[model samples]
Target chain A: MYRGLLWLCFLPSLLFGQRTDSLRIDFRPLLNGVALELEEEGGASAGAREVEVLRFYLSELQLLEGEEVVFAEEDHHHLIDAAQVASLQLPLTLPPGLRYDGLRFTLGVDSLTAASGVFGGDLDPTNGMYWTWRSGYINFKLEGTSPDCPARKQRFQFHVGGFQAPFNSERRVTLAIKPARSISIIIDLDSFFAATDLSQQYQVMSPGELSMKVADRLTRMFRVE
Target chain B: MRQGVILLVVVMMSGLAFTLSSPPGIAYPDHFPTTAYDFRAHPLDSAKVQLGRRLFYDEILSADGTISCASCHSPYNAFAHTDHDLSHGINDQIGTRNAPALFNLAWSTSFHHDGAHHSIELQPLAPISHPAEMGSSIGDIVRRLSEHAQYRQAFSESFGDSLVTGERVLKALAQFQLTLVSAGAKYDRVQAGKDTFSVQEQKGYQLFQTYCNDCHFEPLFTTGGFARNGLRVDTTLNDFGRMMITALPEDSLLFKIPSLRNLSYTHPYMHDGRFRKLRQVLKHYASRDVRPMPISANEQSDIVAFLLTLDDRDFVFNRNHGFPH
Candidate 1:
């Protein structure tokens, strides 16, 4: 009788056979034919020197099918740091047997998470991505040395983040891709440097119109391959 | 079968007794509003709070090992800087704003004079990395704490693991601060029907209800919001309070509304500690050209007498909040 009851409980699971799919995102930081490395000198426009640090938060990942939402990851927050090679590769699990045509994600943390009090994981205050004086997280952090920059060490640091109205820095990216098992996105650093003038605006360590402008520019830098 | 039933009954009764014997978590009066902090996420642990108390008094959090949280926030002053108008940090560097008192933090929705930090757990990061303050990175502190055998053992005991992370440090500090509830004042006693206010205190209480109750509400003694309070800009500091955070012109002079509790201990009041006495604060409020609430000198003294009733002598002298030694 006990064996029969056990079989009754297991029968539904065996019949349905639920399977999980893995989505791996390889974030390649590049400068037009040259992959970027931290603390190493990289060539830029007009004799600009090096790329020292590049980090950003990728959150609210969603898989879309036509106009319908197929899969969404809950509490998804990932911090990508250039110094750590392991951080570049992001692996996420998807619901079983779901076909997705496109991807929708925010390049930065949403306003809800920003307003919500201190949290653990990637959003933890100790991650160095958070601003100490101000409360918001540094959504996108890019620091480097450029000869064109007049600051000490010829360095430029852009820490962009703001969730409040009139200066919200969160940018959303939607990419249409063929239905596939996996996807790879390339973030072109060359385009970012080309559009920004390091000499004119070397540092953006606070949330404001400048940070929003840079965050808006970063929204267009992602491409699916 | 009888023996088995008896054994089960005894086991269940023992479990119920164990549950009843656990120490209480946080205790606040019935009239106070619900705490803003979500305790479900970070449950209270006595071990963690004890570890946090040690970390709060340790100078290892600073770059030069010269300062701790207690340096700026002394327990005698209700965790506020007593005489300093502006806070002094490591290397005797003067900070921009006065260090606010640290109590009833679980009820606070925002932190700092400018409302910069939304969460209490993240507030320590501001002072820890501030150039004028401790000037230490979380990574460096973690590395240092990991090397210390005492901290490692304490971390293991508190968290069931020895590895020190930034999240653990922040959460533990928050745990200790969350326990600093100041609800034992004489005003609280009057509210609970345990005692009665004197005639002078009663008159001051009525005046307070008429003039100050909207912003500095009873129970918590703060509405937990921001207000301008009509203080003109300081030419030297150029500190445009909440405008720096919101970037809105209307928010230019608005600052976080501080609680009225422990007024006697937390002197040199206001965001900049501009007024050393309650009389000056009352004078400023009475003379403000914009929305002035006029009051006579006698009325001002009455308000001061009432404010004194809000002081919780037991909280300030509580040895549990002091150094471990």
Candidate 2:
């Protein structure tokens, strides 16, 4: 009689506890498996070229459980290089029991931080993120000599950053992670280059419309794989 | 020898008495504009002023703890920096612009050459964080100050709480500078009819009224507006005066029109400290077919003489306000 009662309580507890489990997320920028191809309007193929990654800083990161911002950070000063950007995992703590329905984050620094006075540490000019003469960040820098670029021998540089009324360039995205599993978010480089033509808007040096245009398109290319 | 000694003794006695009884505040005359700085925010307390005086002289604000505000704005030369064009900061790093005079700051609407700082309270942040200036963060300065028992007690006394922040540091500096008002001078006496300008000074006053008064207006001697002032841009710096803030193309060469009251003490005029002498400033104005009206050489001399009347000796040599013992 006692054994029957214990089994009755244990059966429902095992069934409900494992059903709504936590999801671990690992964000990755696909470096090797991805092939980037930039084609102009005329269907002219732009060949592959070696490029050095400028920097990747968290402009904004937010974990949304429904409408509320469960966790958010503005002007986070974490600096990541090309090698690190290839595979990045940021551990975030969430509220217990409530699974995150969607996740959203940005790709570059905001316009206000760029315009506000001198900053030290990761934001400093010594870090090579700041533009010395011109005022703004060189966000999403891709440098390599290309056949399509005007300057052939010298590295073809695309430094995009802009945030203002007309030139806002911070990118935002939402993705779904599976239940009770680690979600790996992959940034496909092929889709980023395909979205916008680098030949037309080649070098972006400040917080303006062009930076926002590229960042908005590039941020959407990120997906949960 | 005995008669000469008696005369010298009497002179020394009179000097000692005169120094003891001297008034501390500026004596304003009629016809000047009212003071703009709201002294009510931080009421003038002799004790608080003394505390602020000590902080100004203290080098604890810098990261390396090497420089202070007094290291730049010296008290002897009417609170204007001497012997340097650009103000130097920690690690001997040179700044881009010249440090302006500190007296009569009560009348100033804004601070810095660009007017980047709106309130006088916010002015120290410019120097505190500037890479070429103090080269230290405010948070770092607070942490350093909090470690010292003297600063910890003083912060509690001044702010009521023991916490030290950048806002408190800036406020203390502003409190000290706000007390530097200059109203007593030959010009004030002449305005009061207690004294009159010399014949040359009168001619200079006339010339000043005609040309300089449009911008460098009477009383405070500054319209307190940013102007082109006809300065050619320095090639290396390429600083766009007010345009750095507004991002407007028209405000490219414009800078704040500084007060001309202490022309005798505060040498090296203009934003870049380009001119060493008052005659050079007069010459620059006289040679002005550039932006404002064309001022003549004869008129320039008159303006210089008139500027001399604005100097207040009492405000400059006030022993109470000088470096604390």
Candidate 3:
């Protein structure tokens, strides 16, 4: 009877230890209900617009159980490029039967990485995410053409980045999630257009108050549902 | 005596290992402070430095192959463009600011007058892609270098791979630049107790300590901080210095405080190269409305005489830093 009880106690732990599950985080770029495609005009309240580029760095990803941290990916820096289909999907393995209520992540590179000099992999200088004149990487890049903009080609380029105090453009996002094997995180471009006046403040190639404001708005655009 | 023989052999082997491990480059005086650069991230290799030296002198880095880094940063001029008020780039385009002298770069925390780049490795990208400079993209340079037989071999030898990447290119350039340690000047000799300063030089040194030491510190000759040295805005250029990078109002007109070392060879001083002579520089410092530190003409001449003691002829004429054959 004691042996049977011991087996009963050991079996659950053994099964749980062997049960490692993989979860997929799908980053879907959308304008209302429609999918966002580069160089394609999409409807907005102001007028029609075409997204030329949409790229950003997602870092310090963590899974949380209530207020307690359960799982965290150390040194995780991923560049999500809307132009590339493969970059939109990130696959992560989770511990067996570990209950996670929410996900938290930073929308930019850490200040430590910013000051450590040139890096390879996703943070490579050749990736074009890095600023040529300045040292910091562009945490988020969104370039599009809007009819409301008076600039040449009607282009609006927003390269947001800065790790220094006061002007830091990095944003933290905490998303509540339901228990699921896969999660689709929708990034609505419509909200981004609605939050700012594109005509007056179109080009933001450097770090400043403008970039921080834009980055703040970006933190609100992600929806876990 | 067998144990003694074994000990001698072991010692000889360890000495060989030590020599092989530590590449021959970048020796400074004990008085000099440790460098800001993390050498372990990109360790010094003689082969990489040699490759970088070749790349530095090669015009292939430019879009039209008409300009090179050496074009503006001439070796004889202590790696600074002389005579030109502004740096000249490809297609005869004039840059906005003067090209600063390049030496003792491993110790520098930031690059350019604006302090835009934090890393020495990332600094080259600015000139390479700037329309007013080399007018070439990193991708194009990589492609071009990949096609070249010599560069391909060199890249393979340096990086253990045939691929010529932008990271490797930048790292190699940084390695070559890190080898540029200018601590062999007469001032350095005096500091080392090998020589003595003249009476005029001693007086100037004291004056420099009193008036100039706040920004231009001892040993490294720079505090490596930005300062508003009271130069009026040029109506034509309208350069606001560090404010352009930080977008902060308080940082206005604060350009990088350049090192006093190699000033004898690197003439036409300051961010804009406004003064051709050191006397003019001294005069401006003495007369400027913004926090001016006044010094007499005699004192100014003495300071200039002492500045001449910082000339490192061995460094400027060092064949290693010159054009690779």
Best by DockQ: 3
Clashing residue pairs found in predicted model 3: none
DockQ of each: 0.61, 0.03, 0.65
Using alpha carbons, what is the TM-score of model 2?
Answer: 0.59
Q: Tens-digit lDDT track for model 1 on B1-325?
A: 9999999999999989966765345778987887888776667788999999999999999999999999989999999999999998889999889999999999998999999888888888889999899999887898999999999999999989998988889878988999999999999999889999989999999999999999998788788899989999888898999998887899998999999999899989999999999999999999997988878989999999999999999999999989888
Model 2 / residue A57 / CA error / Å: 18
Which of the two, 2 or 3, has more TM-score?
3
Which structure among the candidates has the greatest lDDT?
A: 3
**Between candidates 2 and 3, which one is better according to DockQ?**
3
- What's model 2's overall lDDT? 0.68
- DockQ metric, candidate 3: 0.65
Compared with the true structure, what per-residue lDDT tens digits does model 3 show for residues A1-225?
Answer: 999999999998787877787788999999656898677443233567878789999999999999888989898799999988999998999887889999999998988888777677798778888889888889999988888888787889889998877788888899998668899999988888898798798988888888888999888889985
Error of 2 at A165 (Å): 10
Per residue, candidate 3 scores C-alpha lDDT tens digits across B176-284 of 8888889999999999999999999999999999999999998989999999899999988999999999999999999999999898788888899988999999999
Better of 1 and 3 by lDDT: 3
- How does model 1 fare in lDDT? 0.87
